[model samples]
Target: MCFLFLFSLPIDTSDRQKSLPYGTDPEYFKMPTRQHLQASSSSKVNTSAKYHEKDDISSDIDNELSVIFRTLQDLRNLKENSTVSPRTEQKSASEKLLKITELQAAIGDLKRRNAKQRIVKMPQKQN
Candidate 1:
């Protein structure tokens, strides 16, 4: 039984020396150098700046939407309260409504574009 067990053991011991620490690959334990750290930090800053810019743009869009909503409410009130109006006033109100609707559509398109850009900018994780 002792002889059989001894025979079952690996005969070659050279492979042991080549084996990495903790039985894993060396690349997994790679240490980041100064240049790599610096580069990564700089990229983080750039990413942060981009995020801030996006936030600013988003806030601006929100503000514009709020203003447009208020204007629409006021227009509705005007249309409801006034029983009679001149032809020019009615035409102008219709034009304002059309312009506001167009602006809303444009803002919607911008929001979609920004969302797409955000998705594209996100990094994929490696297994």
Candidate 2:
């Protein structure tokens, strides 16, 4: 009974298949080997490197776009200020000119009234 049980133990056939050339059998396709693992790992490294470059480029583009937007906003503000500034300055200048003209007219009127009020004294006989 002992010998029968020993002979009936399951045999490991994996060592026998290792001796065959790679890809010679269809069943080995499902199993992964060291070379396959290394190849996949190397490909992953290359893909990660490319991804890092893509991320850097995207970040640079985002920064540039933000800068462009800020510049455009500043330009718009400058345009608005430029358009409004001249009108306000012209209005203020006209107001000051009007005030000066009014003052001049009032002064001339006062001078004319004073000139008309001057009294002439009669010449007295010399004794």
Candidate 3:
């Protein structure tokens, strides 16, 4: 049958001893998950057990991160309605628009300190 399925495919080295290591087979580097994985002969991912893959976001990038938090709370309420109107900051175009409203209120205080930062990822135990 097609020359016994082409002589049953490559099948050599005593039908791959106990798998793994069709490459640097020194008894698959003393296996215990290749005791101390010494990568060299051309790597293929294992950079410290790789895993830091979080960035999906699409739901239209979560409604564009809530329209960039409603355009930084409408430019901090248009810089507190230009410091409650009744202007007169003796021009220089009102001190360069009050230094662009103190740099947009320090970028709305770093988006309110990164909107209360939090990160959690857990899951790893395949030993």
Candidate 4:
């Protein structure tokens, strides 16, 4: 049994070297240095900055949407209020309609901007 075990062991060092994926080079598994760590951290910071920017844009959209809702509510109130003269109500309604259209255009512009930013940030898949 001892003789069989001895014969089974690899007699050539070249065979061991050949088995290593990186050819036994110590550099292949070297620990990351400070520069590499800093670089990675900087990338993380930039990623976070992008997230903050996106959050800001989202908040702006929310604000615009809230303003639009308020405008619509005002229009409804104007319709219900019998005290207001027809001419004044019509003028207010037209003004509110114009404001709504402007808000819609602004929201559309924001959406397009957000979409563009997303496309720019997306990583390209390598073939």
lDDT of 3 at 19: 64
At residue 71, what lDDT does model 3 achieve?
60
Deviating ranges (above 4 Å) for candidate 2: 1-84, 119-127
Candidate 3 accuracy as lDDT:
0.53
Per-residue lDDT of candidate 4, residues 37-122 (tens digit): 99999999999999868755544656776877787777677544679899988887789889778878877877877787788789
Give the distance in Å from residue 36's predicted Cα in candidate 1 to where it truly belongs. 42
Which 10 consecutive residues of model 3 have the lowest summed lDDT?
50-59
| Residue 52 CA displacement from its true place in model 1, Å | 16
Off by over 4 Å in 1: 1-59, 80-86
Q: Candidate 2: deviation at residue 67, Å?
A: 56
* Per-residue error (Å), model 3, residue 96: 17
- lDDT (0-100) at residue 90 of candidate 1? 79
Tens-digit per-residue lDDT, 7-124, candidate 1: 8997787886577677687777779999999999999999999986875553455767687677778766764436556887778778887978887787787687678668868999
Superposition TM-score, candidate 3 onto the true structure = 0.21
Candidate 4 clashing pairs, residues 3+ apart or interchain = none
TM-score of 1: 0.36
- Each model's backbone clash number: 0, 0, 0, 0
The candidate that achieves the highest lDDT relative to the unseen native structure: 4
Superior candidate under TM-score, 3 versus 4 = 4
lDDT of 1: 0.76
Can you give the lDDT of residue 123 in candidate 4? 100
At residue 60, candidate 2 shows an lDDT of 39
All candidates: CA RMSD in angstroms?
16.7, 37.2, 16.8, 18.2
